[model samples]
Target: MTAGNNGTNPPEGDDPFGYLYRSENGAPSAQGQQANSPRRSYNEVRAVGDRRYGQQQRPQPDQSPSPYYAAPETQPGGGQGGSGGPGRRAAGRANQEPARRNGLLIGALAVVGAVILGVGAAFAFSDSDDDKAGADPGASESADAGQDDAPDPDDGPPEEDEERPLPQENGSSLRLENGPVVAGDVEGSRAKDGSYIHGFKEGSAALWQPEIEEDGEYTVFVGYTVPGKDMSLQVSANDASPYSARFSNYAGAEEGDWAKGWTQTFAWVELKKGTNDIRIACGDKAEQCSVAMDRIWLEKGHVKK
Candidate 1:
């Protein structure tokens, strides 16, 4: 048989390395040929051994996946096309610089994008706040006005009503000469209804009986006519010393006009309660009253005139 058909030959003894070229039955190879088969090459056997060893080896979890180059002196070179020399270290440094630069660039881009997004968010928030405030501007002002109009809790109590002045009280009134005759030269006038008392000669006197209830200050007023020179009168209460005084009027024109009436307020006087005696008489002066007295009464807050 030809050398190409040698698979049909018998086995050679004492050939330990000959098993790859010829099996026991001399079967054809997977390429469908029984032609000349040599032992596997050194490179092929080594490649196969490396694959099997790699499968059995454990992976290091801390190994950096992308550090593509490293110096053999520090760490074995892991980059592409690395020669088994110090040139591997130079190539490793060159490739590492570019990788670091790329990493920084990516980080810078991420920061810039974050800044841009933050600025946009800030602007959006500010615009939303402005819109809300502008939606009802006058509402805030009205609320302020309402607060101003509200009454203050600190204000004091309401003012009390003012007290009014007391009303004036009056005592009884009587014709002057109609007072009980008390040792005087006073005479009844011919005037109508005992309207007057006349002839108050010097030292002449008459009295008034007042129905008083308490001992207090009172006012005495007299209505009279003086047509001659000013006439003076002595007024007394209970015949007391300091309780007596003289009152005079200058309302005279002449003796012929003695009938014209006038009124004079005699000063405040004090009276003992109940049925007090009040006297009026011509003055100590010899030429004292020819004056006529008409009405007499008592009131408060008056003075002799």
Candidate 2:
């Protein structure tokens, strides 16, 4: 029978493992020195892991190039013109892929940021346009500011009414009840004839029948004078309850000096929308009645105009 050799042939030497016991065969020991001969070394220097079974032996750095292997300058992917090797080219490609992806990501982010900024600017511009369009351009801010600066109704007097003359009657036109007329005597009398009624010690009174425009509250002003003393006068409108009007010594004059003591006082009264009867008198409930009366007037509101 023939033995199977496959593609390899067996060794035909007397002993293939003889190198393991070469010292017993009179071979030269590495440490022993021979007569007149140089010493031999058994240790050889080569690159670590350069030789392996069924693998090509890598050349040492100090050795010249072998005829079986090509030089680094002539091999593919070895020189500067080509990538260093398959492993190095793959590593370089992997590294370049990350850089490229990062660059693309940065560009995408920049685009998104620009889009967002543009959208925000557009919204801002649109809002500004809408505000301008909705607002009244021709209107003045003074109107709104005036509203804020306006006086509160309860805080102060109301705005002055129009120039329409209020319904009023002077002393000369009014009818006298028990008081006597003093004409052209006292100074600062607003009556056309400068006539005034006075001397209402107990039942003295001045009466008026003035026509009113509407039924509302009215302030009846009496132009009078006191000689350095205060007094309280009685006034009534439309025969309603009487009101006590204060008469102050506004002129600061001496006693019996009715010429220099000229001032006015008022009282609140209600009247109907027609002819209304008004009266001022010094009756039983009167305080000091020694006063010089001059003119009479009416305002529409409870405030003094």
Per-candidate TM-score against the hidden true structure:
0.35, 0.44
* TM-score top scorer: 2
Q: Residue-wise lDDT of candidate 1 within 1-305, one digit each (tens)?
A: 33334664533322222345554587643332323444334345453324421124533567643344434334444343446555776777888999999999999999999999999999999888878777576877888899997767788655448632322211123323433231222233332344555666665676677676456777776666566456667777676643333334455445556544344536467776677777777655646665566566666444444
Residue 166, model 1: Cα distance from true site in angstroms: 16
lDDT for model 2, on a 0 to 1 scale? Answer: 0.72
Instruction: State the displacement of the C-alpha of residue 287, model 2, in Å, after optimal TM-score superposition.
Output: 6.3
Local distance difference test, each candidate: 0.55, 0.72
Task: Look at candidate 1 and tell me the lDDT of residue 172.
Answer: 21
Q: Residue 245 CA error for candidate 2 (Å)?
A: 0.9
Off by over 4 Å in 1: 1-194, 242-252, 301-305
lDDT of 2 by residue, 55-125 (tens): 34566888876635655655555553345666667778888999999999999999999999999999999
Model 1, position 61, has a per-residue lDDT of 67
